[model samples]
Target: ANQEPIHVQIRQRKGRWIGHTLRKEPSNVTQQALDWNPQGKRKRGCPKQTWKQSILDKLRTTGLTWEAAKKHANDHKKD
Candidate 1:
């Protein structure tokens, strides 16, 4: 004996319903990434620190070691 085909329900723009056989499509990663909203909304502000390298340079000029500068940078990050 032969089996009947499966059907899927779809909605149309004008409040109409229709049924058709289901088909699979190839996945698109780029489109998927573009649609994703993991953060919910975009951040809107200037970054906390500008001229990171220049800040390090100034810290070095003040006799602070690179390790000390890095620590200071991390501390500033907490605020």
Candidate 2:
């Protein structure tokens, strides 16, 4: 079969969406939501990995920090 795996497709789409979000104004509601952090305590036990955390982890694996990734995303928008 010549099809991409579902996970691969999902990852590609997520990356595109994140890049689109990064290119938006900081005050944009969707962008704000991406950078938002809750200020409440969890019940207990192991803490869950947040969506932002997972995305950051993937960026780190590629040696890109949040700021760098944002810049890269914005730069690509010009092309």
Candidate 3:
């Protein structure tokens, strides 16, 4: 079958979803969710990596900050 690997497809979908969310108004619920921080206490130990942290780590590899990513996503020419 002519299709991308499942992981590749998932990555592409995530990128597109993030880009779409970034282009939304700052007050948008979905946009706000991206940077949301939990308020509850956690067990004392090393914390698990969060989705936001994971995304930030990936972006760091590409040398892009959150603001830069937002700008890039907003720039239709780069797509």
Candidate 4:
């Protein structure tokens, strides 16, 4: 006997197309516990020293004031 094929739908959000079958599966207790890890414990390191120095170097080359360069770095950090 021929079996029926599963039906699936695709969804689009914010100009992104997502396949229906790619949906996240239900989480069990173990997965839930893993997801509940303390957010405060996460630590992200600063960007590479070479990259930061390059930005500073560029700012100096462009004749930007130290304060302006600092502000630029701060704004970039937000991204």
- Predicted structure with the largest TM-score when compared to the true one: 2
Query: Number of clashes in every candidate structure?
Result: 0, 0, 0, 0
The deviation in Å at residue 50 for candidate 2 is 2.9
The candidate that wins on lDDT is 2
Ranking by lDDT: 2, 3, 4, 1
Residue 13 shift from truth in candidate 1, angstroms: 56
Which scores better on TM-score, 3 or 4? 3
The residue-by-residue lDDT of candidate 4 on 1-79, one tens digit each, is 5744433221113102111111223364432432343434334684334423443465576787546643443444222
Per-residue error at 27 for model 2, in Å? 1.3
* Better model by lDDT: candidate 1 vs candidate 4: 4
Given candidate 4, what's the lDDT at residue 68? 66
Question: What lDDT does each candidate get?
Answer: 0.36, 0.85, 0.83, 0.37
lDDT of 3: 0.83
What are the per-residue Cα lDDT tens digits for candidate 1 across 1-79? 4644332121121111101100111255532432344534445784334333443465576787646644443444222
TM-score of each: 0.24, 0.81, 0.78, 0.25
TM-score of 1: 0.24
Q: What is the lDDT of candidate 1?
A: 0.36
How far in Å is the alpha carbon of 44 misplaced in model 2?
A: 3.2
Model 4 / residue 25 / CA error / Å: 33
Candidates sorted on TM-score, descending: 2, 3, 4, 1
For model 4, give the 10-residue run with minimal summed lDDT. Answer: 14-23
